[model samples]
Structure formats: C-alpha cells, structure tokens
Target: MADLHVESTVQDNTDHSPQNNEDVQKCHVVVPTTGMKFESEDEIYSFYNNYAYQMGFGVRISSKRKKPHKTYYALGCHKRGVYESKAESSKQSKSCKTDCPAKISVIVDYDGTCAISCVSLEHNHALSPKKSRFQRSHKKIDSYSKRRLELNDSAGIPLAKIFHSLVVEAEGYENLAFGERDCRNYIAKARQLRLGKGDAEALRDYFVRMQKRSTNFFYVIDMDDEGRLKNVFWADARSRAAYQLFGDVVFFDSTYLTNKYNMPFAPFVGVNHHGQFMLFGCGLVSREDTETYVWLLKSWLECMDGHAPKAIITYQCRAIQGAVAHVFPDSLHRLCLWHIMKKVPEKLGKLNQYKAIKKTLKSLVYESIQSQEFEDGWSQMIKEYALDKNDWLCSLFDDRKRWVPLYVKVIFWAGMSTTQRSEGMNAFFDDYVNSKTSLRQFVEQYDNALKSKKEKETKADFDSLNASYKLMTGFHFEKQFQASYTNAMFKLVQIELQCMLFCNHSLLKTHGTISTFNVTDILRGKRGELKRKVVYTVSFDEVGRDIQCSCHLFEFRGIICRHMMKILIEKDVKEIPSCYILSRWRKDLKHRHYHVINCYEDLKSGGHAKQFEQLCSSFYEVAHIANSQEKYDYLLKCIALAKEKLSDDSSWSVNTNTNTISQDAHIVSEPKKPLLPPAQVRSKGHPPTKRKESKIEQVTKKKRKINVHEANGISSVNDNIYRRSYDFDLNH
Candidate 1:
C-alpha cells in the first residue's frame, strides 16, 4: 500500500479584519462541511492540512475508493487507527495511534471536481501548537537551508556548528521546523549521493581521475579472493619524484589507525635537502602479517622505480623485520632507537639501582663511538648490574646491530638516529584525519596535509634563497660553506667550525702522504662541569686532501666533524674540499617536481566534472593567448580542427580491471558494481584503548627536574624517573 501520510507545506496567509469578508480567502480556519467543494483531491488535502497544522494535529488519508464514476477519499487524524502488537519485535515501543472518529469524506463528481460528502469533527487527544513543528509530517528542510548546510559541510564546518548556525538564523529552536537529527540524516544522504554507488567505487574513481590528471600518480589496490579491498597504496607525482633524490634513508612506520575500517596507516617517510620530512609514499593495510608488509613494501619499491633505499628505520616488529629483509635485502634495516629506549624503564624499572642502570645503559648506547666500545660497555654493564637473567635485555642485546648507534653508524642517516621523522609526519596528519575518517575523505585530507607540508617546504626554500647567516668563525672553510650550503646546513657547518676552539690536536705519526693526529675534545657536559677529555684519531692525506675521523660523525651524518676541522686548520688548508660538501644539502639545487599541479585540486566533483574543468582550463589558456587578431584567427581554426578530429562516432572502450592498477596507472574504468567496503576489524592492539605513555614522558611532563629525597634510605619514584629521563635528553 502507498504511504497514507499527506505532507503539505503550510503558508501563513492570515486575513485580519474586524469582520470576515466573504471574498477574503481563509487558510487557518479551514472547516470541513457536508457541501464543501474543492478543485481537486490535492486542494482538499491542502485545505485540511492547513487546518490540522493550525490546530496542532496531523492529517492522513484513512481510506480511498476508485470505480469509474464513483471515486472518493477519506481523510482523518493520523492517530485515528487502533495500535497492533507484533510478537516479532524484540522490544516494545510506544505508538501514537488512538481510535479517533474525526474524519471527512470527499467524493469526485462526474465533472471531475472534489466535494466533501461526510464530516466528523472530534479529536481524542490534546495538541500544542508550539510542539506541532516537531511532528514528523510537519517537519521539513527547505531548499535554502539545505544548500547552506551543504556549503558549510563542504567548507569543513562541524555539523554541530552548522545546526547551531541554523538555529541562530531561525531566531530560536521553536522557530526552526527541523531538528539536528533531521539535518544530520539529510547531510548523510547527501554524502551518500556524492559518493555515487558506494564508497569503494568512489575511491576507485578518484584514483583513476588522479592518474589521468598526472601519469606519475601511482596507486595499487590489493583485493582478496572475494574481490574485497584488502590494501591500498598511492603516491603523487611529486612524492614519487622526490624519492629519486632523498630516498637513501627511509623511515617506515605503521602505528596509526587511519580510517574507520581499522587499517594501519603505513607511511614511507624521508628527509629532504632542507631537513624537512618528505613523504615518499604511504599505504593502508588491513593486516600486519609478514605477507601484508611484504606486499606494501614491494608496491612502494615499484612506485619509487625499484630503487631501494640505502637504509630503512622502523619499530621492532617481527613481521616488518622479515618483510624488510625479504623485499629490501640490500637496504640496511635499523630499528628505531627511540622505540627501544622508551621501553628501558618498563623493562628494568624494578631494579634497586634503576637510575644508575639507566644512566649506564644510555652512556653505553650513545657515548660509545666505536662498535667495540659499545660491545665492551654493554658486557660490563650487564655484568655489573647482574642483568644476565633478564630475557628482555638478552633479546635486545641479540638484536643490538639493528638498533645500537655505534653498530649502524657506517652509513649516512641524514643525521637521524630514530624513526622520529615518521612520528613527526604522523603528528602533522593528525590535524586533518582521524580514526573515523572514511577512505575517500582520508585521501582528500591527505592532499590537504601534503599541501600544508609543501607550503612549509616552499617557505623554507624562499628563506634559503633570500636569508643569509653570519659566519661565526673567520676560517676560510666556514666562508666556503656559507657560500655553497643552504642557510640551515651552513649554520650546522658553522657550529662545527666554532667547536674547533675546544678541539686540541697534536701530530701522532706520518706514513707517506698520510698524517695521523690525536684530537682531544673538551666541552662542558649537561651538568655544567667539564666533561672527561675524549680522544679521537684523525687521518689526513696531504696528497688527496682527504681526511677521516675515528668518531665517524661525518660517516654517520653528512656534516664534517670538529676533529676534522682541527686537523684541517693545523694543516693550513685554506678551504674545505668540495667532496665533503654534499649536494643534497646545497641551496642551489633546482627542484623538478614543482611543475606538476596538485592532484586533488579538482577531485571533489569527479568523472565528467573533471573533464569539463580540463576543457575550461584549455579554453581559458587559448583565450588568453588569442588576444591579437592574427592569433584569434589561428585559434579559431585550431578549435574547428580539434572539434572535427574529436567528432568520432566510435564508442570509447574503457578498461575494467578492478583488482590491481598498474604501476604506470593507466586509467582503470570503474566497475558496473562497486565492491563492498572492507569489513571492520580490530587493529593490531585493543582498538578502544588509548596508547599508554612511556614512563619517561609521563614522569617529566609536569616538571623537568625534581630534587631527590631520601625516605627510609630510598629515593622517590618521581626523582628516579626524572633522572632517568634526563639521560634520554643527554643522549640526544
């Protein structure tokens, strides 16, 4: 049966006069009589609906009859019928129905006009005119309000704020006809319409459209055997192109819950020349197994043109470790130093001398400049602290090569010792996306985050070009770096040059063209006392002007160490060699990817809208160029020829590959049926629980330092925690 509820908008057309004029039309005092005539059934409903609205009741069609010449309709109160109970309902709910006899019968005469034949005017329940706006039949969202809500939503305003604005516009809650829930429901349906068919299909269409805009845009969709989306990876052209330059050391972390589907957000992060975090690529994976990690890594490698990074840093996950080994065999796999250090207090916090043990461990990990030094210190500390029986310590010692700073200092890490770059990237994206963000919305917000990051990079580039830093030292080497390196990198070089004052060196030995010198660094420690003199051996070849330091600061980081600077000054070298100045840190390098336009600019309205935008852009450019008469004539001819060439009657064939998009990302046509959205599953850990803060952060959050107090020959917990956290900063 069709819905019996008749919704008619009530317009206020009050006729005010001392006496009622027969010619004045009345709407609020509509009365149903036995001989009332109407133009059609619609007019009858409008008249009764207005009366019901004014009387604070609802009207509906109680019955209808149709037979050639004898057609009639019966209207009554909405709650005029008896309520029936259903056993199938799990819970009982209140119904508004009551056996009210108030009704009117309208009959269609032979002339096709409707007239009231019967009337009964009596109601069973009381009604309030002020509360009538809340009734289901009377509530409505007008076109102006809907457009305003949509505009606010598109501008990223919160729904609560939108509803508040609407309420304010209507003067009060009673003045507004619709409620917040109604507005929310309407917006939800509007979003559904925008995401045509389904969210997965909308995502696929977005990927295809982006790829069409830029061929360098790459995306891969991994589907399960059931054709459901399992994992997705994508990188814009700018990111892909950036990988060619800064992909030597990468930070990959998958700790963030990125979407409503509970997929892990894994981003491959790198550092650009300006020491800014750069996104190489990112992916969303449903699983954290070795197979899933392997596929994600492989897809990223393909997107970066199969040029594996020299080093990759990540948290200590067994699955990721195995995947990194399998997919990037030649790449140096290093565990994040911060991840291991943050667990120090948790793993060994119960020890009686926990502060002493933490201090010794930090000194062993960070102060040791050589692999043998770290090994010897680690063994001595374990034996001194009697920690040989601790399983966690044993496991960490066994995997020392993957996290120990002294063990992995052979390769350049862009001056990074941990995966904090990935953490910083995640912090940046936290402002735009959340756990409830949909896949399509995630991509759109991801573009916004990239734009914000790029704007910073652009500003940094501008600063590098226009700003200049004064040289702290008068050395020719400092002057040379000031001219060659960026302002940021040059400041680092100047710091090293300034530290040469504290570096005292003496000639050790000479062999052929190689001269060795022992340099002692004397600097104030964190406690404000002179630190113990640490000796470093510097080897300099006069013939090649080559220098090497035992500290390996230059080998691990790109900057030349103070020890080398001391030796260079002693040798009377006027300027540093060009080989020591890395091109990655230079200010004059030209960026090639800046020419590519942003991929998400025209993505809000996908498909034909993008095509229309491109045509509009092309025409605008043509019009701009056709200012002169001769150029205008040439453009007219070109337009005619282009139109003729595109006037083909042949059908355009679209590729319908749904499982995987190629690395080149040839446009994959949207499927006739959209695949179902990925099923929700718990992430790697408890989804609802917030991540616990490490002991160091929690303890030091309120105060950076606390005086140690002895109570019954025991130190306070906060004092011990603060001291241990102090060691973390000292190491850094």
Candidate 2:
C-alpha cells in the first residue's frame, strides 16, 4: 500500500477577515510543512513525533534506505500496515493496523541535513487529541523529566505522586508527552545504567570509593558458600564517633524490607546528647538468624572500637537476644515495650471486658514504681482477668524483666524503654528508600540520608551554641545545667524543675549522712479534669551533695526528678553534684570522631583536612580575642612568623590542594571479578510483598472500575463524611 502525503503548510493570502485570521492561526499549530528542515535524523524523528502527538496519532519509521551518498526515510502513522493473524499457540500480541496510509518522507543530502520532501496530515481512523500523548512513538521522557523522575524516585516518592506532580506542572495529563509507564521505564533504565556491572558489584565499587576517600569509612561483606553476597555491614566515621559519645544505650531493629533482594535493614541507633537519633551502624542481611546477627553485632562493635553499649533495645526476637548474649554478654538486652503492647488488641481483644483489662494492664505496667509492686500487680491482674490460659501473656510475663520499665529502671537507658528510636530511624530512611529499590540504589540513597542526618546534627550543634532557654525555677541547679547541657537536654531538666512546683517534701528520718524524706507529688492526667496524687521517698546525702529519688528518673534518664529537686531546695543545696551532671549529655564535650570526615565531605586535602579544621578553630579563637587594633596586629605578626617558619621547614611541608589518592579513583584491589548480587532471600517475618495500595489508589481504582459519570443517570455517593451521614439520616 502506498502512504498518502499532504502539504504541511496551509496559506491563506486572501484571509483579511476575522474568521479567516482565526483559521490561519488554527492551521499554524507547529506542524511540519513539505519544506521543513532538520539538523539531524534524530531531530527529524523528534519533530514528526511531536506533530503526531499534536495530531492525535502515533508515528513510526515505516521505511528507510541508506546508500553511500544519500539516505531516505519514511515516517508514517503506526497504524499504516496490513494486519496478519497468527496461530493461537503463538504469544498473544495486540495489533493496531488499519492501513492509515498517512506518512512523511525525508531525505538526507550529502551534507547530512534532513529536509522534509513529502508530509501527511490525515488518518483513516478517528483521532483523539487527548489520547495522542499515550501513543508509543509520541511518548518520550525528555531530559528534564528524566532528571526530575530520578530525583523524586531517589527521595522515595511514589509513582502516582510523581506522575501527579508532572501532570500538574504540565497543566494536565493530555498536555504531557509521556505517561506514568514511560516515567517508570526511564527510572528502571537509569537504575540499570547506574549499576554498570551489577547491583552487588556497583555497591562494592561505591564502598571501595568511599573507603578510599575516608579511611575511617568501614564496611564488611559476608558471602555465601558460592561467593554470592549474603550480608553487608557498614559504618561511617561520624556514626562511629557518635557511638563513642552516645553508646550507653542502643536500639537495634530489622523490620523494614527496603530492597529488591528482600534483605532487612538493620540499624544500630542511639540518642545523642541533643535527644536526636544518632545512627551507629547499618546492615543489610539476607537472614535473621542468630549467626547473621552475631556477625553484624561483632562487625559493629569492632568498628566502634570494641565498645558495647551498656543497654541495647530491640523488638522481641530470639535471634537478636541470642546474638546480644554472644557478642555483648554484659550489655543489658531490653525488648521493645511498645511492640509488645501493640499486640494487646490482637491477643486479648476477644475477651470479655477487654477494654477494662487493657486499661488495668497499662496501669499495672506503667504506674508501678518498683519491681515487687509490678510483680504483685501483674499477679493480681492475671488472676482477676482469668488470663492464666493465655500463652502469649504467659510468655510476656516470662520475659517481663527485659521489657518492664521498673525492672530495667536501675540501668541507664538514655530515657528510652522501647525501640521507638530505631523505628524513628527506620521512618527517616523511608524518605530515601522503598521496597522496590535495588541494592545499589539503596546504598547510594543511604549516603544521601546520612548526609542529610549529618546536616541536621550540624544545625543542632550550631543552635545549641547560639541559643539559650529561660530558667524556670531560678535554682542554682537549673542555672548549672542550663549552662552545661545542650539546649534539648536542658529542656528536659527544665521540665523536671517546673514539676517541682507540684511536689511537697518533708523530712521523714535522718541517718547521719543520709536523710530520708517523704515527697508528695500532684500530677495531671491526660483527661483535662483529672488529677492524681502520688507519694515518693527521696534520700538526701549532705556529705556527697547527692539526692536520690525513689522514682529513679536520674538513675535511668540522667535527669534529676522533681522529688530530688524539692529535697535539694529544702536542704539549701546551691549546686548540683558533679556526679549527677552526666558528661555524656553535656554540650561542651567534643569527640575526636566528630572531626573525622565522611565520604560526602571534601577529600582533596586527605588527612590534612582534619588538621586544617583544628588550626582554623585555634585561629578563630585568637581572632575573637584580638579585639583591639594593637593586639590584632601583634597576632597577625605571630601568624606571619609561624607561616614563615613552617614554610622554611622542608620536613613540615604539606600540600593542602592535592593528595596522592585521587578522590574519584577506584582503590579496591580484590575480587578480580564483579561480585554477583545476593539472591532474593525470604527474610524473617512475613514474606516480602508489594506495598499495599493507599486510600487514594483504592478510590482511584474504584472509580476506574465503574465510571459513575458514564452510567445511566447514576452518580457517586457524597464523598464528604459529614454530608454522607446527613444524607443517610434524611434517607432513613
């Protein structure tokens, strides 16, 4: 069949009237004419595809001929072909052919310039401008869209949101050249390109590059018998350094499956002095067995200079418990109280008086101030509620020592009794990764997330230095902490100080250095009108200047409780004992690891960068002190003399511009071959599955299933809940 060709240009020389001007304007919609020219063949295809998009049809290269001197091409409607039937045994294919006979012919001259010789603007079938952008040839991801998609995908934005954002930017879906599928395909291709060798190889290459740039960047890879990657662990210098300062307690969790290989993301998280989550280490493991966890914990411990946290919190997992016992025997292993309590409804919801039982259980667990009190309350509740037959409850009781706050209050936990910090860390990571992410992309996004976290910590550090809070109690102790602790920690102490208003303490007895007092505290319940009165015992020591509260808030959280504060004020104690002021939470303490640069930092000067920063700090202090002109001039002279002396010493020469190791060069010398990606493994817990569609998706799918607008005199129900309820009442 021969393709039909039409003139691309429509000229109206006699168009002097308004209607004629409108027609001329309508005709000039950027369509290619018979004499249109292009710089290259790609441009020719692009122009025709654009025209096809505007004309509401798809275009394709129908025919092409190439010779030594000339090249010929014919671009036609995708439907301009004869249809052929195939056997049922063959793979099913959808054909869109109706012999449209619409085409444009182009010729490339000796100079390599393409000029349109013939053009067609007609199609045999009906053309819908709204659907043209969906055409195969017309749908192409432009460079701008590609970059935007990549960035949004890296930031863990869903496809629907990405598509909606693009559609909004383009005004409407009809105005967009590419659809959601094209965006998805482009991102998939980008991932493939990013993983040049493979996912495992690319990740190793990235780790190698990072390690070379930052010597303190640590990573360890575990391989299966077949040498395939089984698990991987890594910790940057900042995280390692942070662990040294905030390593008293840690939260370990591995519930999130954030990669294609289905490896769980395990992060060793801790609370910094500022009460922000500090990542100690991270790992991706195929198995959740005790062996795998032991390896991860040992690797993390080694990275952090073999310092095991005093207490570790985790979800209820036997594998983790066993691993902790093996690697950190002396460390207290506490299960996540939140995770255990979250299962209350599932385990006991069907029982009679379930609400009462749940309320009593909560009071029994949280309100108890001592271990014996909790044990007594638990026994009473189990018998009162007839829960003796509940195996889950029995198991929980067996493990109560690990999760119950009163049992663990004697140990320092940085005020955390649950693994919520780890959960928070996981939530933070959700902004950078999703289930469909590949291992390579996960590693890359990890760096981005870490950099963002570092930026937040730096901002917090700056704020702590320049900001201060109003003293609530006007006590010397409050002033002492306000001057020493970070702003976040000071706020916590201020909370205790303010609570002192509700506390009334009286001397019960005195024993030489120790005087026991009974303290009564009035606290408000969550219900607005409810108030509770509780009595606590406080012991004060005049020799040591120490006051211990029976509430044990100071022992557990490193903050003085209201009872202790009240007793101290009664004793006329003007200053807090240095023993009570924890250096771990102090603002002025600095760790060497804080100076260790991460892979994201500038590495041109290598190890000298840390020295440069130290020198800059010293110079800044000197500059701050030299307020007078005479002192400033003398300081400048001293700096000049030091510089001269340093320059004259040949052995002290250091180049600040270049290092022996190029930042971009690959330094890994092992594996001689690219490593194979880890096989998709079935991790512990529920098997990995696609994320459940959101409520918006469910509504959209429902709308798609039944178009109410097109139904016979049918309409969708009122979407507003209040309106729906009102309408229901009216109908009733």
Candidate 3:
C-alpha cells in the first residue's frame, strides 16, 4: 500500500510559454509498491474535483494517461497550460509474491523518470459549496430579525422588577433613586448582547463606554449653566418613596442659599426628631413672599402621598400664615415664640416697651391662672398701655384653649415656649449642605446627619426617662417609707414643710437657737426675756413638724431652709429627710452639662460680648449713684451740727450802729417813740399832736455801712442799715 500526494500552484496570466510567465508551478508525485490502477479517467476526474472542493481550492486536472503497467497525471495549470504532473509505477516481481503473478509497473512524467509507486489515498471531507446556497438567505433573515427584535438594555429589568428590587434593597427606597450601582446593573443585564465581553479587556472597555454615557446624561439633566445641580425639585419617584417610609409630622422650612437679594434661593427643609432637616425641595422667593411658601406646602403634601400633617410650627410671617391656612387647614398651626418675641417690639412701636410686654406674655403662656384671673390680667394690661381692646389679642388668649394645658405642663417647665427647635435644626443643616453637592449627594448627607442626631437624641431621651422614673418612684417612696408615714400623709407633710421653708426660716432658726440656749444655759438670766420671747414665737409644730418663721428664706430657696433644718432637728429628724430636698429647686445650683448659648464661637465672641459689656456698664453706674447717696446723707448731718453751734454763740453777733455794741445792745438799740391811746385809736383820729425830736437826732447823723459777709457768712462789699423810729407826730 502507498500514499497519494497531489500539489499544484497557480498564477495569474495564463500563457503556455514559460518566458511570458513570470509564473511558477510546482508538482508532487506518488508511487505505490502494490499494483495501482486508475481504472478510468472518469474516476480520476471525480476524485480531483472532490479533493479540490473539500479543501476550498481552485483546481484543473489535465487528461490522465495510462500505459501497460503505469499511469501519469498532471494537475493545475500555469500560463494556460499544465506545467505540473505526477507519475506512478505499479510492478510485481516473481520473487515478491507467489499467489499473485509478478508484475512491474513504471510511471514517468515529462522527465521520463520511472519508479515503482503506489497511490496512497487519504480522503478529506469539508462542507460543499452547494450546501451554502441557503446561507445568504439565512443571514439576511438573522440581521433583519435582530433589528426588529432589538431589546433595550434599560428595559431588561422591567420597570416593575426594577422598582420592586430597589424597594426591597433600600428598605422602601425612602428617598433613594437610581445611583451608579443601580444604573450599572441595569445596563449590564438589559444590554447583554451589546455589552457582553468575550474577554477581560473587552469588559473594561465596555464599562468605560457606559461610564461616559451615564456621565453625559446625568450632567445634562442635573446641572444648570454654572455646572451646579439645581437642587430644587425632588424626583417624583423619590418623593413617593420617602412618603412611604416616613409618615406625616414632616416639618418643613426654608433658608437662603445666597446673600443676593435679587437671586434669592430658598432650600425647603423637612425635619424629624433627629434634628435633621431632610431637604426635600428648593425654590426662589424673597423672605416676605408667600408664593414659595404655598408651593412648598403643596409640594410637601404631595410628596407625603397626600397625607395631612398633625401640626406645623413656623416663624410669625403673615404671608406664611396665609399660605399655611390655605394648604393645611386641619393642622394645628403654631407661631415660633422666639420669632414672635423678636417681632413683638416692632408691633409695639419701640424696644423700650418690649420688656414689660414680654414678661406679661410669658406669664400668660405659662401661668395656671383661672379664666377670670387671666381676663383680669389681660384687662389690666390693656389699661396700663391705654390701648383699645384688640381682637387678635383676644383670639390669642382664646387659642390657648387648644394647646395651653399640655404646653403649660411640658414647655413651661422646660423654659421653652418657641419652635427654636426648627432654628437649631436649620443651623445644623446650614453646615451640612455646601456648594459642591448635587441633589442626590445632599439627600445622602442629610440621611447620615440625621442618623447621627438620632443616636444622640435617643441617649438623651433615655436619660430623661430614667431620671423621671427615679424622681417619681425611687426617691419618692424612699422618703415616705423611712419616715414610717403613709405616702399620701407624708406628701402632705412635705408640702407644708416646703411652704414653711420657703416662707419663714429666720423666726424658726431664732426660736430653735433660743430653746437650745435655755437648755444649755447659754443665755444669761438677764437675757431670759429675749430667750423666752424667741422660744414662744418660733416653735415647730409637734404633730406636723411645721415651722413658723419671718426670714422668708424657706419661701424663696425652697430647700430645707436653715429654719426648717432647726425644726427638723427639734423633731428628731436626725437624718435629713430627702422629702425636704427639692431636686428641681436646686437645679439652678447644679452643674450644667449642656451649653447655654450655642457652641458657635462667632456668636459667643462677637455678638454676646457686646451685649454683656453693655449690661455690666449699666449696672456699674447704678451702683456708683447708690453709694454716692449714702455719703451725702452723712455729710448733711455734720453741716446741721455746725449751724447749731453758730446760733448758740453770743460773740458771733454783729453790731449794726456806728457805736460799738454788745449782742444785747444790738437787740435793744431800736427805740419806741410813742404809743396812741387805745380809745383814740379806736375812734380813727385824723391827726395827732406833734412831738419834740431828740438832740442826738438833730446832730449830723453818720450813715453806717455794715459788712454782709460777717452777718451771713457770705462775702460782699457793704450793706445798708435803716433804723425804725416809732414816733406818732403830725406836721402842720
């Protein structure tokens, strides 16, 4: 057996002449050891055609030639002629086989070389050209069908499935919409045909393409001309999602983003117990405009799945009030007391009158007075101001019926009467939202800030709960049980004790000290009246342990006043009863942990310093004036004593006449000339008899000048003196 080899090379320009052919042809031949036979040209042609077709090659076989024992064949052409050929030999010698007759075969080509050869036939199978008749038609169908059935990558998840999945993963998707991961998974799954990668490099390239596409779309949709995202409207899906997660009680407010009055931007906020204002929307409006307020309220309600809120608190803006009334009719609308207080002075026309009004308003809010008492106080306020009765003020007082009792219990005791809670939340948010954030990023930051605030508030609420419990049960019972008194009776006694401590401490303390003094003989018998007087006046009730005192320290401090302490000792309450200790009364004295003013350095260092300095200067001047009055009083007393000494001395007198005179002479020098009869004076006489003048009067009279500084302690040049003469003389 032998194997067959067939090889041919073809070239362009088919001409038989080798000179004209820059073409080459190569050939391979095969020989068979066993006798080989072609049998017929038809078979050779069939085999050549089959081989050419199977190998996907062009072939032309030349005519096959047969001899007595061998055959030659040429295959393929170059230069329009067969230049390549193969020869085979078929032979058998007598010594080679016994059964078969010996035969020798030789095949020769154009070169006439002969050898024994066997054709070794190996069959190669491949797809035939006839089989591809339907390929083009099938390909056309595939391309057209693929186009008709084009599946959107975004559609693969089915909106329902995407929504459901997001809802599940995000726990209702509260306020979350699609982010990078969501978008990536959606693109990958829905666009499997387009985006699938056959290799790692292809996968990386696909991801880069997707990122570019997503970025372009996100940028166009979110950002404005300045490349800053318009953080105004929340996506509809997100708004609904948040409504599903959080029920009503969503508090909303707004803050300015820029200082520009013209380009006003307000970021609307919603707050929770965590003190976080989850920014849900934004708008453009002035502070005084109500249009934004109305829109915000409507949008917020729509966001909350159309659920009505239980309450709303905001600053005292008339526009806001009108908007709120229009939008949330059922909600309990309240004014932020801080804002109300701030605006009160403006309403009253001057800041000078605010203090008095503020005090009165505060008392009205917090005090548990009867309706009549409230009315009387209100009337008195109007009278004091000489103002006509205002309907709004009356309405305010009547509105107290809605929330007063509860507010009085909680807010009054806490010293909070305002929705300052919202302001605090706003302050927290102002620090959180910055210029760089997109709406999506802002939402995420808000959620995180809220979580932190919730943790802190939870801890505080727990501590307050525990304290309240201890105050009500633990401490309350301990004091009652220790005193071997029934709880109700013990509480009654405690109230009386507290009242006495608050009202009368000094008298009780003095009485107790006096009683001890008599027992120890600390007081002498001469002081016995004082001791007895004090003892009789300051005795603690033997049955109830009530103490009567005049110091009123007990009424003021509410602690076990020193007087109460003495009474407690006298009653053999050796160990101080906790009942006498009012924890709340001592709260002011206790160390405070919370910051009084905000912890912001700007507020403390700048605004607060100016106010504190002004207050200090005012109090200093008042103290100086008060001290000056005390010194003036003592000086006045000394001046009075000096004036008394000047009146008592005789040498201090001044002589009025030219002749020297003693103090008695100066008093008696003035002469009485004459006296009329009482009967004549009663008759109203027209004229009287002339009298002779004294010779001393007829002599030249000297006009004397007296020094006024010597008489009245005032320095002056001269004083005129005139003497009176009582002479009843009638001139003819």
Best by TM-score: 2
| lDDT by candidate, in order shown | 0.76, 0.76, 0.38
| Candidate 2 to truth, TM | 0.76
Expressed as tens digits, the lDDT of each residue in 1-732 for candidate 1 is 111122223332332121211222233354566788887777788887766666567787877878888797788888889999998998989998988777888898777789888877666666555577777767789966886777666555668999999999899998888999999999887766655556677777778878988898999998877778889899999998888888898988887545778788888988887777889889999888899999999999899888999999988778899999999999998988777777787778899989999999888887786678788888998899899999888988999998887777667887674324235567667556766778766765677789888999888888988887986767898887877787777877777776677889899999999999999988666575886678889999999999998877777778898899988888999977898999988888886766667666433465775675577678879899899999999999998987877765364566777767756577765556556677776666522224333233445443433433343455544443322210101121
TM-score of each: 0.71, 0.76, 0.29
The superposed Cα distance between candidate 1 and the true structure at residue 72, in angstroms, equals: 7.2
lDDT of 2 at 31: 59
- Which residues of candidate 3, in runs, are more than 4 Å off? 1-250, 255-288, 349-354, 389-421, 433-732
What is candidate 3's lDDT per residue for 309-347, written digit by digit as tens? 655655545567789899989876665544444445555
In candidate 1, position 643 carries an lDDT of 81
lDDT of 2 by residue, 1-732 (tens): 222122335452322111111111122345566788888888888888876665567887867889888999899989998988876657777789999878889999888899989866556676655577678886778756775787677665777799899999999887788888888888777766655548888888778777888888999999888879999999887888777778888988887544778787888888887777778989998888999999999999889888888889988777888999999999889987767776788779999989999999888777777678888888999899899999888988999999887677767888664324235676567567766678877776787788888788778778888887988766798889988999988988887777778788788999999999999988765463436677889988889886777777777788888788888888889987798999887888776656877766222234674575567678779889999999999998998998788766675756776567686576664546557789988755532222232233445657764576548566765443111110000000
Candidate with more favorable, higher lDDT: 2 or 3: 2
In every candidate, how many clashes are there?
0, 0, 21
Model 2 alpha-carbon drift over 4 Å, by segment: 1-25, 28-57, 65-73, 89-93, 104-123, 126-142, 157-176, 350-357, 383-390, 418-422, 528-532, 601-671, 683-732
After superposition, candidate 1 runs with Cα above 4 Å error? 1-158, 161-179, 197-199, 349-356, 419-422, 468-533, 539-545, 562-574, 601-603, 606-674, 679-732
lDDT of 2 at 722: 19
Rank the candidate models, highest lDDT first.
Answer: 1, 2, 3
